[model samples]
Structure formats: structure tokens, C-alpha cells
Target: MRTLVFLGLLAGFGFGQGPQATLPNLVPQVVSPPDFPPELAELEGLHDAGRYREVYEKALARKDAWGYVLASYAATNYARYQASDKERQDWFRRAADAAREAVKLAPGQKGTPSLNASVEAKAYFALGQALGRYVQYAGLFTQALLVNQIRSAFSKAIELAPDFPDPKIGMALWHAEGVARNICLIFGCRRDQVQVFLNAAEAQRSNSKRVILGYVDGGYANLLINDLKEAERGLTTALSLTPKTAEDYYEQERAKGLMEELKRRKGGSR
Candidate 1:
């Protein structure tokens, strides 16, 4: 899952302070889902190589649901790392559109085959991720609207695959962001709800959860809520995890960045 790009904006709000990080600031790698498609290995290879633009182009070339899904993923990455300020939102919009196309093509329910369910859930997740990034550039009213849609997409993804942790982490981020901004009362986000979703996600770590940045995301969310102890715990867990891929190493770097923030916050109060 992609990290929050809007977080840098929170620096002025007494959260997410420190060095600015972009969405694709972390190294890229491929994580194949169960029932991996044999034909898509080349595109996956491109993504794993961090050739995001080529991945997007070749993925959309296939013109299938899975193709669109990968296209969305690649486009999101490209937007985060490569696009200029003026072009970033356009790429995110393209990503969201590709994800919508993927959902339209997949069209399945919770009880469907694992591959179908995974594809549909991924499409929803991709859509939510794109919207999440886009919200950073939107006005407050647009942000409210986008946040609701992000919640809806994430909730639907969870309903489809109860074990998938990405959407859960996304929901946790949503609640945390709302709490940090002190807008929970107006938006209906609760502090407790953050832990609820985060715990649910951590429970799946032994099963379906693979990305390490999600742990960084969890810690970052905790930091947003002023839960410094939990923030340290989450970042510590991320640091302790053995890294096997470029994504792992880069995510740990992110965790380390958060750890620095955690340390500064703790030390300054003394």
C-alpha cells in the first residue's frame, strides 16, 4: 500500500513533522497475490524493477480487469514519485479511473473465487488510494466528500475480503487523520475506531499482510492521535521485521524516520 502524501501538510498542525517524503519515496517491489496470473509476470517484473511508467503502459496494454488493476497501481506510483505538482493530481485521477474500470470488469461478490475476490478488492483499494492522495490537493469540502468515498471503498473491500489488511490500515489512517485535525466530531471519526481497525489489521500479519510500510503507516497514525507509546511500539515492530525486498528496506527507512520523530517529540517534552 502507498504511504500518505498529504502527511507533509500536517507538519504545521503539530503532526507529521520533519523531513518531507513523497508517495513513492520508498523503493518499489512486487508482491504477487495468491493465484498469480502467469501472463502478468512481465508487468510485475517491470513494477519490481521500479519501472513504473512502463508498468503502467504495458499493464493497460493488456486491456483486462487485472491489467487495469496493475495500471492503477503503477499510475499511483508514478504520480507519487515522478509527476510534478501540476501533474500529480491528473495521474491520481487516471489511477482512480483505471481502478473503476477494473471493478467494472471484475464484478464479483465476497464468496467468489479467491482470485476474483482479490482482484475486486484490489480495485477498490486502488481507488481508495488514489482518492486518498487526491484529497491532499482538494478544498475542505472536497476533502470531506472524498474522505467519505475513501471510507466507502475501503469498507467495501473489507466486506469482500475480511482478511485483507490494506483497507483496514487505510481506515485506521482515516480515523487517525480525523482525530489529529480535531474534526472527528464533524466527520464522525472516533479515536477508538483507529485502534479497532489497526488491531484487526495486525491480526492478519501472520496470514495475508506482507507490506512492511503498512506498519509504518500504523505507527504514523498512532503519532497523529498523540499516542506516543503506541507509536514507538508500532515503529519498533516495523524496525524489527526482517527485510527481504527493496520495499522492505525502504519501508524500514520510513519506520526509522518516524522513530526519529517519536524521539524528538518525547525528548522535547522533558
Candidate 2:
């Protein structure tokens, strides 16, 4: 049953289904679903060799059909990394369209709502994440809208699946806080909100999560309430538990960066 579930997930590619589109970003290789596809080895053979784009096109090249649409939807991550900022949203929009269509192809209430909701939920989340990237890369200077969108997407994700501990939202909140701080620098808004968001991130994942920045999140979170000892404790824990491979690096780096920030602030305070 587990193997069947894994196969089911991998068969769809990444998420949705459709023609041909773009990606949101480099889909971190670490976050694969529990249930993957049987032919994953085959598809992976193509993707790992950097032929995923070619294979994707070939799979969908034959017709303007459902599978084709689905393929595009699944391949959005690839497209996101390959395209310019303006083009990334195109990929997500395409996935959203394709996912909306998947409702019809699915079985009765069971499959239909599940497929459609999952599709839409992810599309919305990806759309938000891509927009976050756009603000940073495209020189949009629109932190207000970007943060709002990100918060909305995360709220929707929780609404869809309250049990989910979405890492994307964790990362998004971090980025959103950064944007807010930078954008509000002129107006002299509260800087503490940045720490607030980061704390929420840590609280959400500290036990089961890794420090993307090495020791910074722990360093800062522990220090924020004047918990320097606890901060060091948490960060030190992260350093020991941190994975040597995969997405753990992001957390490691995050912790490292936060510690640096703390030191800088301490120096400034002195």
C-alpha cells in the first residue's frame, strides 16, 4: 500500500497535470512526497540527466490533451528555474488552469474534490512563492502585495490541510519578513516583526525541523527574549542534528545568518 501510494504521487510528475509550462523555482530535491510513482526511476533517469525538459515535451507533444496539460502542470518547477521572472508566473498560471480542469477527469466526490483541492492549493502556494521570488529578482519593490499574497496562500494551505506543516510557508514567512523590514526601513516601522515571523517559523518546526542557516535561527530566537543561553543551546542543538545533505543546509544557513545578525546587533548596542 505504501509502495502504491508512492507510485501514485510520482506518476503525476510533481503536482498538477497539463500541456507545457514553467517552474516556480529549483524544486528542492529533498522534499519529495512519501508516495512516489513506479516509473519514477524511468522519469528520474531522464530528469537526473537534465533531459526532463525534453522528456516532458515528448510526453505532451502528441496532443492538446489531458496528459499533455498534466505534464505541463507537473513540469512547472523545471520551467520556473529555466525562465525569467516574468515567465515564472506564466508557468504557475498554466498549472492553475490545468488543475482546475483535473476536477472533471477525477472520479466522484472522492477523487474530484481531492484532486481539485490539492491542485488548487498547491497552485496558490506556488503562485505565492513565485511572487516572493519576483519581488526579490524582478525589482518589483512591492513588498506589501507580496507579503499579503504569501500570508493568504499559507492561510489557504492550512485551511486545506490543517495537519500539514508546510515548509514553503516557513520559508515564505522568513522571506516576507525580510521584505517587510527592508521596505519599511524608510518609514521606520517596527523591526521586531521580523523576529516575530522568524519565531513563528522556529516554533512551527524546531523539534522536527533543521536549521537552514546552521545556527542562526536558534541563536536569534533564543536571544530575542534575552535567552542567550537558550539561543546558544538551540543553535548548538541544530549544529549537532543538522543533516549533512539535502535541504537541511537552508536551515543551517538560516541559523548561521541569525547568529551573525545577533552579534552585529550586540556590537551596535554596545
Candidate 3:
């Protein structure tokens, strides 16, 4: 999972709001079904075993929509751990291409029921992540241009799986970082949009009973929006939750770092 590390900074703050207001305790309504195909499962196993190249190769061999999405995910991870910028760019582009292919073959586009809603949602989520990675490497002009695409892809994923927490996190980050980077360019973007998405993400995360990324993401968004109290609460919640995967552990570390930063900032203010 790509971390929105760019949003970690508190610089160039805009769109000021008052102290974070308390959000009502919302029960999460989303339930993600185990919808991965056998082939995809095999790819995941290989990926979990740190066999990225094999996962990529097997995923490519499958030559299906899900395969492409899985391949994109594997490629993205391979790129993530690499040291070279050129390699990262190449792999991210490959991941983006595969995700695009998956979208084209996704069901319910032209009223085709070939693929189920869950499958289609996964593809859109993958595409959103791929686009986000691309945005990280892109120049300011290019990043500005791709923000809408990122938001749209994640929105489609949410439309497909309202209960899924990942897309909501993605959407929240999109709003938070988009506003932070260039508020004028975002269409119909509101300063409160970040809080809205964060609330949704927290609800989804609670409802889904899955990963811990939601808390980490929400905490990071709060940090970006200068909601220190909320940031602390969110990250602390994330730390208390059990991580479900290596990715979750990675996010936990990030949350810890952010918590430390928050402490530093608070102490400085005092």
C-alpha cells in the first residue's frame, strides 16, 4: 500500500478550521467478502512469501482482468522496495497500465455481468493506488491534472463497495492532500471534505473488521488538517488494533512516527 507521506508535513497550511469537533460514533456498514479467485489467491500467497517476481509472472500468465490488477499490485510493491527511482517509475507505470486494463475488462461498465461487483471494486481500488503512485512522481502540473482521476477511481470503488474502508481512505487522502497542495485547482472541493472522508473511512474500517490502514490514514489526514487531538486519537486507535498483514505493520510504524511528531509539536506549543 502506498503511504501518503507527502501529506505528512505541516507546511503551507491553508483553509483553517477551528478545533476538531467530535464526530458521532458511526458503526461501520461495509462487509468485504472474500472474493479473490484461486489464481489471485496463489499470487497473494507468493506475494506474502516475498516472491514478487514469481507473483508478477504468474499474474501475467493468467491474462485476466483480476490477474492484471494483481500483477499491478505486485509490480507496485516491487517498485516500492526498490532503491532506484528509474525502477520505481517503470514499475509504477506498469502497474498503472495493468490497472487500466483491469478497468476496461471490469463488469457492469456497459451492463455486462461477466465480473461481480467485488471484483470490479478491487480493480478500481488498484487503479486509484496506481494513479496515486504516479502522482507522487509527477511534477506539480501533472499531479494537479491527475487528482481528479485519482478521486474518480476511488469514488467508483466506494460506489461498488460502500463497506470497504480502503477506498474511503484513498478518497480522504485525495481530498486532504489535494486541498493542501493546490486548493484552487480542485473542483467543488471543500475544506470539510477531508473530515467527511475520514469519518466515512473510520466507519468503514470499523464495519469491515479488516486492516488497520483506516486509522493510520485518518490520523494522517487529521495531522494534515491541523487536528492534533484527532490525529492523536486516530493513531492511538491504530496502535491498539492488531495488524493483519506486513502492510498493516508498515502502516503501524508510520502511525507511531506520526504520534511522535504530534507529541513533539504539542510539547513545542506548550
What are the candidates' C-alpha RMSDs?
6.1, 13.4, 9.2
- Candidates 1 and 2 compared: the better one by TM-score is 1
lDDT of 3 by residue, 56-160 (tens): 778878777878777877776666543265677677778888888888877743221212446678789888877777766666556655767888999999898
- lDDT for each candidate structure: 0.72, 0.41, 0.65
Identify the leading candidate in terms of lDDT.
1
Against the hidden true structure, what lDDT does model 2 obtain? Answer: 0.41
lDDT of 3 at 232: 91
Clashing pairs in 3: 30-163
- Residues 1-270 of candidate 1 have per-residue lDDT tens digits of 112344333322211211223334434434555312556766765665457788898898877788888898788767765566788778888888898888898674222323345778878887887777767766654665777788888888888778778788888988888788776655688999989998998887654424576788889999888899889988998888876443455567778888988999999879
Q: What's the CA error at residue 17 for candidate 2, in Å?
A: 29
Error of 3 at 107 (Å): 2.2
Compose the digit string of candidate 2's lDDT tens values, residues 1-270. 854543332221111111132222443232223111323334433443334455455535433333333344345534443445556555555543443343333222221121223433443444444443333322223444444554565556556544334433334344334443343342222345434545554554532222443244435434544545556666666656735322344345455555675667667767
Model 2, 55: alpha-carbon shift in Å?
11
Runs off by more than 4 Å, candidate 3: 1-35, 81-86, 108-117, 206-210
